[model samples]
Target: MKLTQIATATALFFTAQLAFADNPETQTQPAPAVEFLLPSVEVVASPPSTPLFSITDPKAPRQPLPASDGADYLKTVPGFAAIRSGGTNGDPVLRGMSGSRLSLVANGAPIEGACPARMDAPSSYIAPESYDKVVVVKGPETVLYGPGASAGTVLFERNTPRFTEAGVRASGSLVGGQFGRNDQNVDIAAGTPDVYARVTANKAHEGDYRDGNGNTVPSAWNKWNTDVALGVTPDADTKLELTAGTGDGNARYAGRGMDGVRFRRDSVGLHFEKQNIGKVLRDIDARVFYNEADHRMDNYTLRETPPGSMPMAADVRRRTVGGRIAATFDLSERVEWVAGADWQVNWLASRSVMGIQNLSDMPWTPSATLSNYGVFSELTWFASDVQQVIAGLRFDRAAATDDRQSISGMMSSMPNPTFDEQRTRVLPSGFVRYEQNLRALPLTWYAGIGHTERFPDYWELFSPNSGPAGSVNAFAGIQPEKTTQLDIGAHYRGGAVDAWVSAYAGYVNDFILFTYNTSMGKATSQATNVNAEIFGGEFGATWKPDGHWRVGVSSAYAWGRNADSGAPLPQIPPLVTRFTVDYTLGAWSAGALWRVVSSQHRYALNQGNVVGYDFGPSGGFGVVSLHAQYDINKRTQLTVGVDNLLNKAYSEHLNLAGNAGFGFPANTPVMEPGRTAWARLSFRM
Candidate 1:
């Protein structure tokens, strides 16, 4: 059933029953307590858009079996893709944009990966099911988050539950699948109105998976996490929360020369909120956080070192500290405003050991330090019931310092020109949007324009061996990226049908791009600046034919061009479409999803982002999945699904080529799994 239909029926049903009891003489006895189960949320590879933004429950069951990280889950959304490396932890890309162009925040903090090769992208540290909500804002539609969000902003948050009385609340799920895949998650809370405490934990493990050809690829992983939150509510309008978390994991990579021996995380945070302060001053929100990641990579940790290759190990670590303060104001009946400021600082260090040496005995070396401070304001104006406007402005100061003393190459060593040098930039960003609702028709249309200036990130400035010509290095040579984009969208809602479409076009000046070259069996990376253009659109429609049946379809397409070289941008995904059919009856619900991806021939050889480069061209493929949900009782539910039911062999366009150690030719893309069955059981109290 459509979401609207279900809501309408529920409202009408309660209204009718209440009207009958208006007269005391006709009042009936109270009905027995009963639970009304809502239809289960079906997992679709490509779901329809939700208004100007999208909010999804991270714990909900999703297709492609189970997502291993935040990136895997985001792929189910249109206009989003993952640069695959192995079974999990693919780097996320949106609208042909990747890297730091996308702002990723968890619990109001940003935790950047430490790998120079991007083996552990930021998303790799995120376990989707651990968070309560996943929120996404596409395009440069808002400037309240921070700078450098030309592609978009993603947030993973956990809501602090407030209690009115003493009680216990809990929710959990267990999952199992083929190839020794299994996971467990649990969340529990108990307390009184004055104070409360909550705890969440999860564990997941999977063995090497076989491709459609029954070939085992070097992909396997195991991880676990635990977090706790304590909250104090002194009054009805105030709340203070303290939170801490820790986690660790290890994974075997299929596209790299080494395996991740450890991915350890430590975090602590404090948040405060106060509401209903006065008429003009609405509320205040403030938060502070600290996060650290310690990662290690070694060729012999998870697998034997290849012949003629020396045993080597590298350890890298990153520490980040940040805080945000915001206030909401009601200037007038038709005007509302939000103003905020955020600041963050990060420290990075690394050390390596070779030839059967003790890694811990080596001292860590400090490499880079980065810091940024931003201030922003957003205002909303309601001209009328059918018209609205929103505008936001932001400014940021970014700074970075290099700490290397010397550089070493295969041939010679040179003084590090940028050593002890600091680079800084002042950036400004803003966006304005106008929305109008048709009086006669159930429709809304909106248009927006945004401009953003992005400073070079850690990878762009420090990872590459060389910078643009005629400069000391990337730190001093690369310029900040500037983007100007226009976005337009429309939404329509009628009796039994709802549809929406959104499109974006943008031009980028001084875009940061990376190129790879090989010499004497060693690869060297170079960073450069270029001009580029990008455009994309996503559309979807859903129709409810009857109370128990619904059908929907969604499609997404993206295109890009490198203006300087007159070549197609690398790592652009092909056009894709999804079809879904759903049925609901009482306590049982079923669904079927079919996904199709078109061929991509655009190629910019040896050119791409840090995660991967384009592999000439990839062919189209189709896959179908079936899922069913059953509500065993008010507090218990079970979901079962089969993905790639036909056992078809396929590889995504944005993929990393398999490494030679994995028994595959160098530069050969890895194949996805085939015909996997999975089941999940969830309970709440």
Candidate 2:
């Protein structure tokens, strides 16, 4: 088919689907009771409100992992995917959306890494095991955080301490598992009724991981971190906090060409929250923070470079700093409001020696750097006890300024030059929603529409050597992406028969894309501002008609398409369903999870049926799990779980490229592990 015809067809398909979101009938079905089972070690057994697709909540006591970097702990959350380069630092993705789309916050502050290729993704600097909780809010449902979360927002927070009377409290855990996974974590707090001090530390390491085929993948890593904070609570309504932290780690990769030989990070922050100022204003939660990262790559970190593979390779580095402030107000008993602003700036530098057989010295590429800043706010109004309306708006301006006398790796015609070019962008976003609670039917219904704008991130700009004929490097060349979407859903609970369902559809403009050319042996990608459509829903049910037995089943499906390209976007997973059943008898609960994923058939990059490396159309795989928990007294518990019990060999649609260095046989491919088991012991005093 002609390109125009293909484009026309794609546009028409999306137009019809996106328009369906407003029908309201889409959410008429009853909602099933769907409770998420968080990670065994740090899990919050149950809560008054069920937080879907979330693995952690702030109510639980903080328990740092015995040993780990941030990426290792993210795996505990379902629907989260990561690109593996090494053990300590993995690129994090949620619902297939990656890069700058997802916002990462630590202790309610923002910090980004300095690597051009994302050698130090923000999450990599975090010690997940060291924090108290990890909260993930999916989709663009709320706007209270910073900006550009078209995918979602992830908040890794440290729990706050409150004491009515003078007392000291502490919680700790120890874990020893397969693959040399030994972790020890401790959280301690002590002070007078009005003051408290807290501290956390962690470390971890692993050898190369063997895939299902027993072929080792370059995943070896080593890392450690420490955090100290002081809190003063004059009263329950007001509090002040000051925090400082430092962490560093290194990883070896089999998939990427380079390894992270050095991962050094430093950060400091201050936050204050005041509540109940008057009848009209509720409180102000504000903060200021600074974070920096330095990364190094060399041949000695992973393995000796092969011939013709840029040998004698060594040394590269990057750095970044960010800050923000936010406030909340209670206009009245039924209405609340919020506003905030944030900014980020980063710099890059690299030096390497390359030659034949590690013999000669090649001059290093000149150091390069860029800077960006944005200003962004959000508000909500409650209509009645059973109804609410929420609206939010934000405007952001980002600019990239570079200072250099000469440009490296440019065309010959572009002779010597010394000047500065700066590009500034303006973006505005807004959303509105209405919710209703029908007490007569014991059900709650909500519907909303939102639009968001995302600025181009460093990876999209600095990583690419060239942009389209008329554009600059991705940073200056790509336009800001905007998304207008509608979300509608309902929750219902009817004794013995509970169910739930939520659906959403979106229209996207200026959707970024990446294309790879195997024949040319190079990756060709760009940001194409095109219309797009996305829709999905999750449903589940639970039946416990009588005591001692229970049956439950749940399913989720999401789909996305680029209307202008007539091609399926990368990393969109196929339909998936999960079934669980369990029994409870005399102090013990046992359950099983049976999951099935349909085969993915739509693809574009590699061909009509593409299926490999940063591409799509992956075959399907099934997995099963068995779990049990024992309540050993009110303060202590023991839980054991076995994953992939059948030892099935499988992989997710989104996967990391395996490095050739770490022992992955050239002709053979690597797959995730077949099976794994874990046990958790918890103590609180």
Candidate 3:
């Protein structure tokens, strides 16, 4: 169905409902006991809940129109950026770090995408609204989730639900906007004291958008997802749950030679939890999960085939299986400890067909397999009322195997130098921290040091065309990356005012880097190692002068240099700041957000990660947005917003060069969407 038709139908339905809700008879009824509060539209994300740790509700209304994917949503957080690839599935970067440095977990399991070029990053499969909570832990501060989190860790989780009696509850949202943008979501749950079931689903679509110059950009997409969970709560303190989910989508990218014609996901999981087992043993948690991503990209699916080029497509898939077991212990009155073990394995395979050949008929070829096993323990010591200490340690055994029989080059296939070869390494990571609270003021401060040893991932090992100098291949030449860092932060929470600042400095040994080179009209990439130094920080403050007024400001910056070459690191985001002001009166609220980014004069041309490479220096730009919300009742809310209010033409420094096949000039960055407006109606029962 056409997006405009869908938007018009949705508008008529919502209008009728609003009118019915205003009827005198309905107005006299008493509200339900379970009042669903509608939070003001989130512009700039709130300050961290604790030093370097942030928690936010994923379901909350946010500006820049509600995000279509996880990476889009994370842009609201300080120190977070994305390498744009059209309108959706941008690769997320944290503190100037991307790829495997940042760990992403969903329901305690890791899901990896299959695209060698990172067309479908891990965040691409995530539908932010389908989850209940988002937790971001910056820096390598903890060891409970997984290993090699030198950048940070992001967790998307769902809380277990319990009921005292048999009952049913549901929540939903409908949104429509310009450029034929629309979305629909529904979540329903039913439960009794002993058992519960839930179903969540959503669909999103958008047409090609125009830039400030009113030129069309090839950035259209459609996606849908559905997930279900069933739980058995035999007792109040113990529960078991099972979950299954499937989703698929397609996206058009103006920065690539092909469009994503398929993004398919399948997953299943089992979880068990028991709390308050004894005085010393507080809780035990165990979970197992299996996830698979089947992705396909083509030149003729979402757009016209380029002149003189035949239709071509590639299909890739990755299957991952993982499990974890953890237990919490109250060792003493002043000390608490949590310990866990985890194991993960994933395999990648692919097939390609050209010249009107059927891709499905091509036999899939297994390319690589990777695995990791780790044990971890974290201890927190409450020494006194104002002083605390935290420490963690983990050991991981990682291994990768190359299964390819031959390497495909620009002209012809060649024998694989490292075919059927395997590499394994035993690595360790740990952290120690000290935190203190001021006795005379509402302030807390912390300092920590952490170290992590990371193994080479798939992209660094197999995607590159060549390895470092004097090496057989990337799979055999790349060495493990070791990072040691120090972090310090402070936060103040006084009545009407809240503020936070976090900073880090790190040195990396054998940091993996990618270099792009084009020769004879063909592009190639090579993987190499270098010594690097990195530092960054994020700061924010919020002031609530009165019950009806709120003002906030946040800023973030990162700097990195290649210690070996004395050159600036590629793909680093420039300094950015956000300002927001909000006013609330009764059930109505209004807000505006202004975001400014500094010009990035420092860059390493043709060097970056698998997602994108630095094309050249980029200029900075500023944009403004505004939003307003009205509560129709305790259970319903309507939010409207205008994005890019000034209709500015801007492009982020961390962006891909426009593809020639899309009729874009060479070495040009894709522009962001122009001025657009949208509205969303949400209800809970």
Candidate 4:
């Protein structure tokens, strides 16, 4: 569908909803009072709400001046790290795993990026502040959202608006910080019992940030998004909604040869939900969505062209359409079953121009087309008041077709052996878990085992220049990745203490690995398969000794090795920990956060994923930050904070090397931002 058509339809729907609210029979109600205040800043995310699952409010103010994108916000959660490229749009890594292993879903749809180098990752398109809820399911423990979530699954969702009478509700925020940073957000909803309309929009911008050494990092970005939703509530048990949104952004990357001049996103979706259908069928939910990502990068748009290098630009786009249907059944008094089927189809195309030609004017070339169909069922049995069993099974058929007439080689275009060829795989995934709640103590323990088979993603199949030995290319050589893992965890909640710990160990067969090599002054990457072993864990605790005081601590660690080569895995994050203390009194509160990260000594040189590589050993560092909040009124609040208080210059272990075009030495990791201050004003009515 066209963007204009979607926008026009949304406008009409919103007007209709408002007109319905003007009915003489409709009873107008006063807005409710705000009863609770959100935390000033989230230094460390609260412990998981359940076994391997966490739910967070995405609109809450957070440390480090909030986030510019989804990945930046996930870093506050333990076991989550980001591969930073610049001021924004960092790629998210969970348990040292990247790529398709982590399923990212936004509003019941999967959005894929078109950049072969992954400059615009899936998370880049997600505006976290625009969503009402963020749910994280760690590990391959569930089969509800999608397939191949061996590392984890993250969902960004917007709750359907419901109203008892004719009324309006709104919330918003404004932010300002050093380095020319600023942000604005607004959310508004209006409705009666029969219909509702909601709108959310945000804009964020920043200039180049300085490091501890007082050097500019060549990082800057600007982004904006607007979304609209109209819902019809025929009864208390049913809801039907339609959503539309569009967003665009630009960024200057310090770690790549080109800067992103455009990141255009357009989306449309329809959702249906029903509950309490019958004695056996509890509820049914279904949705269909369309998402498109049109991206462009150039060497001259955001910065000056390198000396003696001609200006160059490339444009690429991916169009995805998907639908899913799921139903929940009360099989017995104690057993509940959920079954679903989903299917998706995506097409990618690109065009490029050199010198003085406009890239957009060039005719597009078809690159690849991919599709998947999956069916899944999950069962939960409540054996007793204190015991439960959960199991799930899923099967997927995935296929990819290469549409390229020829592949690019080191020196020139070459005949492609896999041109116009199709490859397919049938994969299966399943998991089982047992849970026990101690009757005498406020604690719960659980254990589970899961196995998954993942088809090679676009980056692994087409981005590499070469493939395994004796293979034509990555598309023809890379094999499916299979992982089997055991997970165990415990959660304890009592008087003043709340704590949780989770751990996982897994063996991966045919794990995909990338190796970077420089020959004849040209850098090329090869995709290969290897056996790998991985293990990791995260622990956290919070102590509320009294109503006025709160303290928290959390840490995460991950390790991996190539079983075939006996070498450490590339791009694994080092151990990291956080300590937080807060004091609240009346309408004012203050807090402090200290973060420590260990040095990384084990790594495979020049090897990693499509986005980053292991350059060398990295040094450890620590930093501190402080924040305060004041309630301006019942409906307004103000928050202020300073990050990197000590001006510590450090780089994360999972990092991309600084681009030489930005005046940084080859193989040098990009440095993080220095000491900075920021403030945010939020209000609701």
Per-residue alpha-carbon lDDT of model 1 for 21-139, expressed as tens digits? 35456544442354645336555432324446778778777776768888988888878889988888889998889999998888778767988888889998898888888888888
What lDDT tens digits, residue by residue, belong to model 4 across residues 1-685?
2334434533554354445445545535533554765555688876788877888887877897789998999989899999999899999999999999999999999878999999899999998988988999888999888888899999998886678777888777777788878788889998889999999999988999999889899899999999999999988889999999999999999999999999999999999999999999999999999999999999998999999888989999999999999999999999999999999999999998888686767898999999999999999999999999999999999999998998877558887789899999999999999999999999999999999999999999999999999999999999999999999999999999999999999999999999999544456899999999999999999999999999999999999999999999998999999999999998899999999999999999999999999989999999999999887666667788999999988878888788888888778889999998887777665
> Candidate 1's C-alpha lDDT?
0.84
lDDT at 479 for candidate 4? 98
Question: What's the lDDT of the predicted structure labeled candidate 2?
Answer: 0.62
Candidate 3 positional error at 142, Å: 0.9
lDDT: which candidate is best? 3
Q: Which model is ahead, 1 or 3, in terms of lDDT?
A: 3
Model 3: weakest 10-residue lDDT segment is: 23-32
Worst 10 residues of 4 by lDDT: 1-10
Arranged by TM-score with the best first, the candidates are 3, 4, 1, 2
Which tens-of-lDDT digit does each residue in 1-685 have in candidate 2?
Answer: 2334434533453343334323556544332333323233231112113323344643232222222555556543444556555345766766556777788888887656666667677788887656777777666766767667887778888866677666555554444444554444556777676998988776666666555556555667777788888999998877888888887778876656677777887778888888877776667777777766767676654677765565555554455566666667777777788877776666655555545333124344434455545554566677878888878887777666544344445223242232356667777777788878887986777787888888766666555545445765554566777878787777677787666666678878877665445454443344434566777766666678777666766666667787987767666656767666767765576777777777877645542111123444578878887777665534444556666788777765555545455545432334665565654454444
What lDDT does candidate 1 reach at residue 54?
Answer: 71
Evaluation by TM-score, superior candidate among 1 and 4: 4
Kindly indicate the candidate among 2 and 3 with the higher lDDT. Answer: 3
Q: What tens-digit string does per-residue lDDT give for candidate 3 at 1-685?
A: 3557756766776775666556666544543477567777998777788876899887778998899998998989999999998889999999999999999998778878999999999999999988888999889999998989899999999876787777777778888888888899888998999999999999999989999889899999999999999999988998999999999999999999999999999999999999999999999999999999999999998999999888989999999999999999999999999999999999999999877788998999999999999999999999998999999999999999998899998868899989999999999999999999999999999999999999999989999988999998899999999999999999999999999999999999999999989644456889999999999999999999999999999999999999999999999999999999999999999999999999999899899998888889989889999999998777778899999999998899999889889998767899999998998888776
Q: Among all windows of ten consecutive residues in candidate 1, which has the lowest summed lDDT?
A: 1-10
RMSD of each: 7.1, 13.3, 2.1, 5.6
Q: What is the alpha-carbon lDDT of model 3 when measured against the actual structure?
A: 0.91
